[model samples]
Target: AQSVTQLDSHVSVSEGTPVLLRCNYSSSYSPSLFWYVQHPNKGLQLLLKYTSAATLVKGINGFEAEFKKSETSFHLTKPSAHMSDAAEYFCVVSLGSNDYKLSFGAGTTVTVRA
Candidate 1:
């Protein structure tokens, strides 16, 4: 079994600044983690993912995350924020037992201010 918890419901940042979103997860076996972003009335897009192959993962739109086994955390970060980055983000954990079984976090809404 694998599960993910998003630590924040909302995150606000200024345009052209930095961004951070927190997440925690648990799994019975080694887990695969993912970050997804969704804009209003838009489909979810894969932001990044962490597999056994890499501890650090980078994704499109200057987003990245680091897998920390010691803390059971996979936090998303961006060196600079853009207004277009305003969206809802989800933390996902893959249940290795089942290919279709995936747990999703509630979601964190990111607001970019001018």
Candidate 2:
């Protein structure tokens, strides 16, 4: 079993500036970690994932996440924030590859300023 926590409930950044969303996870077995983003009234979109392949995983829209086993963290970052980046983000964790159970974080709301 695994669980995830998004450290910040809300984050605000200026357009064209860097953006960061913190996430931490706990798992009993090897886990598959994923970051999902959802715009208002839209389905969640996959941002990135880490499945024990690489410690640093890059995703669409210039987003990236680094998995740190020692720190038990998988924080997401974007070099430059865009207006479209304003949305809710979730941190998800699943147990084994075949495991159907997925734990999700509460979500972090990102607000982009001009």
Candidate 3:
């Protein structure tokens, strides 16, 4: 089984500044990692995923994450922050090929300052 832990419960970023959401994971075997963002009253949206293909994975809205096996971290980052980026982000992990069975982190709330 795999588990995820979001290092920070909340993160505040000024508009146009860099945004970083820290996350760490532990898995018995090679695991698949993902980052999902959910806005207020909206469904969860896929940000990026790493499945042993590439160390650095890029996603929508200029968001990206790097899978570090030695560090056991999959941190999400964006070059610049936007007001629309304010939301809750979750770190997800799956052990096998079945994506349905996933383990999600508590989540990190992002607040964008104007």
Candidate 4:
């Protein structure tokens, strides 16, 4: 069985500061890694994804993450934070290209202070 673990359950950042969210995962086979953001009272939006080609991936809103095989990690980061960026983030792992068998992390809540 595969699993995804988010190291931190919450992260707080002041507006205009940098942001970081950590994640780790284990899988029997090579897996697809993804980061998604859920705004308050809204649906989940795909942030970035790692599908084996490139280790570094860039997502919308100046978000980016690196897929590290040695550490089995995929950490998301942003150069600057905005108030709107305050949301819950999730790390996901999917095996063999099927969405149904995906495993989601507990979630990291980001709070941006003015």
TM-score of each: 0.96, 0.95, 0.96, 0.94
How many clashes does the backbone of model 3 have? 0
Candidate 1 has its poorest 10 consecutive residues by lDDT at 94-103
Q: Global lDDT for candidate 1?
A: 0.93
**Candidate 4 off by > 4 Å:** 97-100
Model 2 CA deviation exceeding 4 Å by range: none
Off by over 4 Å in 3: 97-99
After superposition on all C-alphas, the RMSD of every candidate to the true structure, in Å, is: 0.9, 1.2, 1.2, 1.3
**All models: lDDT?**
0.93, 0.93, 0.95, 0.94
Tens-place lDDT digits, model 2, residues 1-114 = 578989999999999999999999998765799999999999999999898999999999999999999899999999999999999999999856565677899999999999
User: Please, what are the lDDT tens digits per residue for candidate 3 over residues 9-113?
Assistant: 999999999999999999998799999999999999999999899999999999999999999999999999999999999999986755568899999999999
Q: How accurate is candidate 2 locally (lDDT)?
A: 0.93
List model 1 lDDT by residue over 58-85, tens digit each. Answer: 9999999999998999999999999999
Range of the 10 consecutive residues with the lowest summed lDDT in candidate 2: 94-103
Cα shift from native, residue 59, model 4 (Å): 0.4
Across 16-81, the per-residue lDDT of candidate 4 in tens digits comes to: 999999999998877899999999999999999998989999999999999998999999999999
Q: List, in order, the clash count of every candidate structure.
A: 0, 0, 0, 0
TM-score winner, 2 or 4: 2
Top candidate by lDDT? 3
